[model samples]
Target: MSAFPLALPDDAELSARLSARIGQHWHRLLAALRPLYGEGAWEGELAARLLGAAIARPADLRALDQVREAAPDWFQKPEMVGYCTYIDRFGGTLAGTRARLDELSQLGVRYFHPLPLLKPREGDSDGGFAVADFRQVDPKLGSIDDLRALASDLRARGISLCLDIVCNHTADTHDWALAAKAGDAKYRDFYHVVEAADQVAAYEAHLGQVFPQTAPGNFTFVPEMQGHVWTTFYPFQWDLNYANPVVFIEMMDVLLYLANQGAEVFRLDSAPFLWKRAGSDCRGLPETHQVVRAWRAALAIVAPAVALKAEAIVGLAEVLPFLGEPEQPECHLAYNNTAMTALWAALATGDTRPLSTCLTQALAKPAGAGWLTYVRCHDDIIWGALKGVIPDETLARISDFYAGAVPGSFADGQAFQAEPGAVRSTNGMAASLAGVRDGADNAAALARLRLLYGVTFALDGIPAIYMGDERALTNDPDYAVEPDHDDGRWLHRPRMDWTRNGGPTHAAIARFAQLRQGRACLHAGNPARPLLTADPALLAFERADRGGDRLICLGWFKGDAMTTDLSGLLGSGDWIDLLDGTDVNAQSVAMAPWGLRWLVKKNG
Candidate 1:
């Protein structure tokens, strides 16, 4: 093992540099892996493989590794705004997306997450989540070379490219799955395939339905494999068995391969369901955190520039472990699902208590990690995640209100995979959910949109703007008519209309971005502290940096004018509203209908 040759540059200095990096992180990496894989010859072999991949890393990426390692909190900066879109819907292809970098730059976007462009099963691939090939790009989007070129172009313009790497399952058509179907015992062990029906039932008892109405069960029996394969999501997506050490090795290699291709971030899709244990919910288990920590350690050694974001859309308690403690860091970022769901609940009920509760709980995150805050994304707004934080009846009412079932509701959204007596998930574009429609009050709708985005931008995290939301794009009317897109989530996944730009909605977002820039108080390192107010309709938070710079953010959810006393919160300071250059009376602050304010000490 000691004599293993390293595949590095001919320059002795470069080889020594890479060797020292391995030496620094090797103990941490082994510590994370030993509990999962124990003492074995495979450990030495795996280390050799990882070292080779690190040496083979591209020169430009190595340079990036040095820069990111120097400043580990680059992604947590105040100016780090994210834009997410599909390659085809946004710009038609990778080259087209590269050409439209100007649009992203205008919105002050520093992180770009183009929705899963990886190759998927030919038809009905769960909207590209069912990845058939991790190494290849979806032909419709472009080739792997095109992705590399796009990543290079994005990096040149100070943007980090984020790609989704589905960690829990793979499409049945994937090569490994095909090999399993071909009766390869070694490859067959990559996934959980039970030969008995009772065993499947035992596991199903602890699992919850992901798409109860659409895809149903947690196991699918295949005649070719002659067993029931674990399918937590869809029948065509087989769940990987992490009990097998080889599976972990394979996925870690995939991360390094993509990092070398200039991809700066990996969204670990379906991350919480990685480690499955019999007779347990099998979500966010201890083994899952270990796997993520090991991956983080490996990235620290090989490509320190690459960061992982967990797509753990569970409750707040379950989500925190994914953002591990500072001593043993897991993912660099995790989705703020609790706050996202609570924000919607507050808007519907005209009460900010639930949102305040969630934000207060969210203030405690790992020092090195940040939250991925957003107003809307590609997926449905699942209200079920807020089960305990919000009352069941309130969740139901909010869900119905967003689904347009409530009387006089301005929203025109649809319920997704809803079951009777269950907390419902709603789907629609941001503008439509904000009440933009044919006969609605467009001014109020635009204000609602601005108000929601204002809170997201002011929060302590990297706020992500879903595609087409900046222009206040409404729901896709023809979504249901599209082929294999009957899923209601597509309603919000509208194509970008580049021709129709510069609306009031777009202007509002640009203004928020401008205000967010260069403000140390808004940095992710400074957590937002939720403030209690007398009015339930007003949501308030204060963000203060180490340098004594303080910013108070207020969002009024109701459609009527309201005033709240902020003297208690903003004591002894003459504050000015950063949104509009107006002096704020600390004793009595007045808010317009659906108003938002970012307050900072005047001339401090």
Candidate 2:
């Protein structure tokens, strides 16, 4: 039984030297940093020491100079819109991405998340999640100079570049893994390699299988190494052992190294699984929180401007803990997984009961922390884990409903990762989920699209649009033919079709986006969880100034002949409906099937 060392050795003299180095660079800012990190914290002191070491090294010093002048609260903004796309999918490479800055700016996008551009092991790189070399870019995605130039261009346009720092695991072909396989004792200490099957069995007993269809075990047998290597996601991607303090220091070096590369925000992929313990699920362990806390402490001390965004794709209960207290920080922003899943589920069921429940129970985000809300992303939709709160039978029905298996269902989606017992994840574009792909050119499809977009825009976090979703791009049937995109996610990850720009659907999208863009109520404003005045058929909420002005959004989840009267919520007045150019009385406001009315009180 090898107990992992959790702390570093004595370095008080080294701390003083590092503090002086930082003081020399940032004399004025040290006053603000001292209060946040405390007088003498290990993480704070270590970050300065690491910064000093980085400056002495033969790498570029320009990033360090920029760090000294970086803004403290650059992430906090009302109009911050995010755009996530693969460099190859959006452009072709790093330089190609530089060419599209003007287009991204047209969408009012201030933050860009280019998915995993780092070097990966050739055959199975888990879509670049399995990082081979943390220090360099994928040769396929141009050089470090291209990335530096792109970052400079993005910064000039007020767009922050967000990159993935895959903290969970590294590719099997990484130098450290290769060394460990060749009987290098020092390298073996870098990862969790077990000689005994009993230890491996203990971990597997409590651990949840990530990709149960493909990778079955928590630990994989690496024959070349003649040992069991911990592989949480896949056999080729070995998990790094954080029990060793050196691993912490080393990964921190990787983090700051990238931050210096002009990365304003780091999307910490699979962050919840950083630490593992026996007799536990080995996810979101106490040590995991501590490690993240240590990283937060380090960032506050050195890079006050750079923010840590967590990618924890867990249940609603486990999500809020990532956003720690303002004084002692964890992550600046977290993916709104519960709300995202709920939105899909709501659309399928044609009832906002689940959506309302999620909003009421699970939407209490911390003051300083923000939520990155989106309809879809590059990952598979994880369904069953939240089954404890939402029943398995309900989840199965929802899955079937979206897959077009259930009769009279509007959604035209394909199921991914379908297990033996009817458990599955759904994949489709926003338009497909709205039933527009089912050859409908009528008002029903348009109404459904509006219903989806209205809920998306009215949600409590930052709204994100999947690249061409604004123009009602349906699922691409040909993506399944390609080997790399065979995993049904490509059903939604289609190329931007500018040819359809002149169509009626495109005009509809433009109108919706115009409404979305004009709403000051939806942008960073706290909307009260809509108290359902009507039946489960209608969902309504109010984003109020709380006293002076109010913005009310009402939508009918289903039914062709349903009506909701909101005279109780809105006392009296003729309001302007942003969806249609009509002044309607609040006393008898009626909406069509799948119709949404965003009413804002008008002043004389």
Q: Please tell me which predicted candidate would have the highest TM-score against the true structure.
A: 1
In order, the Cα lDDT scores of the candidates are 0.89, 0.71
Off by over 4 Å in 1: 1-10, 418-421, 438-440
| TM-score against native, each model | 0.97, 0.86
TM-score of 1: 0.97
Kindly list the per-residue Cα lDDT of model 1 for residues 365-443, writing each as its tens digit: 9877999999899999999889898889988888889989999898889888754568879999988998988555699
lDDT (C-alpha) at residue 241 in model 1: 92
lDDT of predicted model 1: 0.89
Best by lDDT: 1
lDDT of 2 by residue, 112-187 (tens): 8898998888875778889999988999999888887888898788777889999988999889889988889878
Candidate 2 local accuracy as lDDT?
0.71
Candidate 1 versus truth, CA RMSD in Å, comes to 1.7
Q: After superposition, how far is residue 173 of candidate 1 from its true place, in Å?
A: 0.7
Q: Which 10-residue window in model 2 sums to the lowest lDDT?
A: 1-10
